[model samples]
Target: MDKKIKVGIVSYRNTRPLIYGLQHTALSNDIELIEDIPARLADKLKTGEIDLGLVPVAVIPQLGEYHIIGDYCIGTEGEVASVCLFSEVPLNEITRVYLDYQSRSSVALLQWLMRESWGIFPEIIQAEDESYREEIKGTTAGLVIGDRALEQRLISTYIYDLGAEWRAITGLPFVFAAWVSTKSLPASFVQRFNEANAAGIPRIDEIVAANPFPVYDLRKYYTLNLSYQLDERKRKGLELFLSYLKKDNEQPVEA
Candidate 1:
C-alpha cells in the first residue's frame, strides 16, 4: 500500500477557504490532516513530524530545507483585521509588546515592522498563556491574531494592522503563511495539492455563508480583508519581507 501524505494545517477562520477543497473533496482520502496553530505547525514541519504544512512565513528561514508548494496563501493586501497590534498608547510611545503564542508569522512581522518600518526596537515578551487581556497590562502592547484580533479590536484604543503597515512602507501585499513541504515530494502529488488549494478559493463564499460571526462581518473579512492568491505581486512582497527578516536576524542585541 502506498504511504499517505502527512499534512499540517492551521485551525483558524482565515484558513477556512484554503482548506475547504481539501476537506470536502476526494483528495481528503490521500492526505492525513494534522490541525494546529501556525507556530506549532511550523515546528512539526521542522522536526519532520509532518511531511507538509501550512507554515508561517517566519518559520521558512529556519526550516533549512523546504519547498513552498502552492499558489494560495493566507495573505492580505491591506488592513487585515485578524493580524494586528493592540496598544494603549501611540506607536512611538509603545516600549513593550507582549507577543501572541499562537502565531510565529505575526510576531516576526511585528518585529520586522518595528525594526525596519517604525525604527523603534521595543522590548518584546512572549505571552505565557492564551488570554490576550491577561498578557497585556499598563503600557505594554499586545500582538493578537486570528479570531482574537478581530474581537479584540473592538475594545483596543489603538490597533495597528500589520498588513497595512507593510503596504504603507513597501507598497505590496503581505503573505502570512503558505503550504510548504520539507522534502521533495513527487511532482504529480505537488500538482494535486496545488489543485486542491485552488479548489478552495471559490468556496470562500460558502464558508462565509454557513458561519456568521457575531463580532464582525464575516463576508467582508473573507472578501475584502483576505488575499488568497500567490501571484507575482505577492511573491515580490514575500521576497521583500524576507529581506527585512534577514537584516533583523543579523542585528546584535544591546548589552
Candidate 2:
C-alpha cells in the first residue's frame, strides 16, 4: 500500500473548489487533506506535518526546500473584493495601518505597495480580528483578506484591492496561494494531483453552490476572485513577491 500524501490548506472560501474537487475525484484515496489557517498551514508545512499545502506566497520564503508541484493557484486578475485596505481616511493620508494575521502574502504585498508606490510610512499594527474596522478608527487603515474582506464591503468607505494594486504596479496577475510540496513526489502521484486539480476547475460552479458564504455570489466569486492556473503572469507575480520578501528581510532592523 502507498502512503497517502498529506495536504494542508487554509480554511477559506476560495479553497472550496480545490477541496471539493479533490474529495470527489479518484485522487481522494491517494491523499489526505488537513485544513487550517494560512499561518498554521505554513507551520505544518515546515514541520513536515504535511507533505503538500496550499500556502501563501510570502510563506514560501520561510519553507526551506519546498517546491511548487502544480500550476494551479489562488489568485486574481482584477479588483479582488476579498483582499482590501479599508480606511476612513485616504490611503495617502493615513498614519497607521493594521495588518491581518491570516495572510502573510497580503501583508508583504501591502508593505511593498505602501513603500514603493504610496511612499508613505505609517505605523503598522498587527490585528487578529477580521472585523478590524471596529478595533481601528480615524486616520488608520485595516488590512483584511479572505472572507473578512468580502464582509468589510458593506461597512468600509474605501476598498483598495491589493491584488488589483499588484497588477497595476507590476503588470502581472498575483497568486496568493499555490500548490506546493516539499520535494518531487512520484511522477504518478504528481500526475494524479494535476488531474484532480484540473478536474476541479471546471466544477467551480458546483463547489460554490454548496459554499456557506451567503453574502457573496458564489459563481461570481469563483469566476472573478480566483485564478486556478499558474500562468506566466502569476509566475511573474510570484517571483516579484518572493524578491520583495527577500529584500524586506535583508533590511536592517530598527533599533
Candidate 3:
C-alpha cells in the first residue's frame, strides 16, 4: 500500500468548487484530506503536519521551502464579497481597525491597502470575539473574512472588498489562496490534482445546489464574483502582493 498524500483545505464557501468531487475521485484513495480555515492550514503545512495545503498567498513568504503545484486558485477579478472590511466610518476617518484572526492573507492585504492605497495607518487589533454587530465607538472598523464576512456585509455601511480594492489600486486580479506544498510532489499526481480542480469549475451550480446555505447567493458568489483559475494576470497580482510583503520585511519561517 502507498502512503496517502495528506492534503489540507479551507472550509470557506469560496473553496467549495475547488475541491468539488475530490472525495469521489480515484485520487481519494491516495489522498488524506483535512479541512480547516486558511490560517490553520498554513500552520499545519509550516509544521509539517500536512503535506499540502490551500494556503493564503501572504503566508507563502513565511514558508521557507515550498512548491505551488496547481493551476487553480481562490481568486477574484473584482469585488470579492467574502474578504472585506466592515467599517463604521470612512477610510480616512477610521482610527482603529479590527483584524480577522482566521487568515493572514486578508490581514496583510488590508495592511497594504491602509499604508499604500489609502495612505492611512491605523492601529490594528485582533478580533478575539467574532462580533458582527457589536459596537466599538467612533471610527472603528472590523476586518472580517470567510462566511462571516458575507453576513457582515449586510449590516456594514462601509464595506471594502479587499480584492476589488487591490484591483482598483493595482489593476490586477487577486489570488487569495493556492495549492502549496513543502516538498516536491510527483508530476503525475500534481497533474491529476489540477485536473480534479478544473473539472469542478464548470459544475459550480451543481456544487452549490448540493450544499445549500441560507443568506448567500452562492451562484452569484461563485460565478459572478470570484474566479477559480490562476492565470497570468493573477500571477502578476500574486507577485505584486509578494513585493508588498517584502517591503514589510516579512520572512518565510523555516519549516
RMSD in angstroms, all models? 1.7, 1.6, 3.2
- What does candidate 3's lDDT look like per residue over 68-126, in tens digits? 98888889999999998888788889988888878789999998888878999888788
- Model 2 residue 203 CA deviation (Å) reads 1.6
Order candidates by lDDT, high to low. Answer: 1, 3, 2
TM-score of 1: 0.94
- For 58-162, candidate 2 gives per-residue lDDT tens digits of 888887687898778888886777889988778887998999888778888898999998888999998866556686568888888888788887777877899
lDDT of 1 by residue, 169-228 (tens): 889999999889988989888878888888867777788877778998878898899988
Candidate 1 overall lDDT versus native: 0.86
What TM-score would each prediction reach against the true structure?
0.94, 0.94, 0.94
Model 1, residue 11: displacement in angstroms?
Answer: 0.7
Q: Which ten residues in a row have the lowest lDDT in candidate 3?
A: 128-137
Query: Candidate 1, 23: how far from true, in Å?
Result: 0.9
Judged by lDDT relative to the true structure, which candidate is superior, 1 or 2?
1
lDDT of 2 at 11: 91
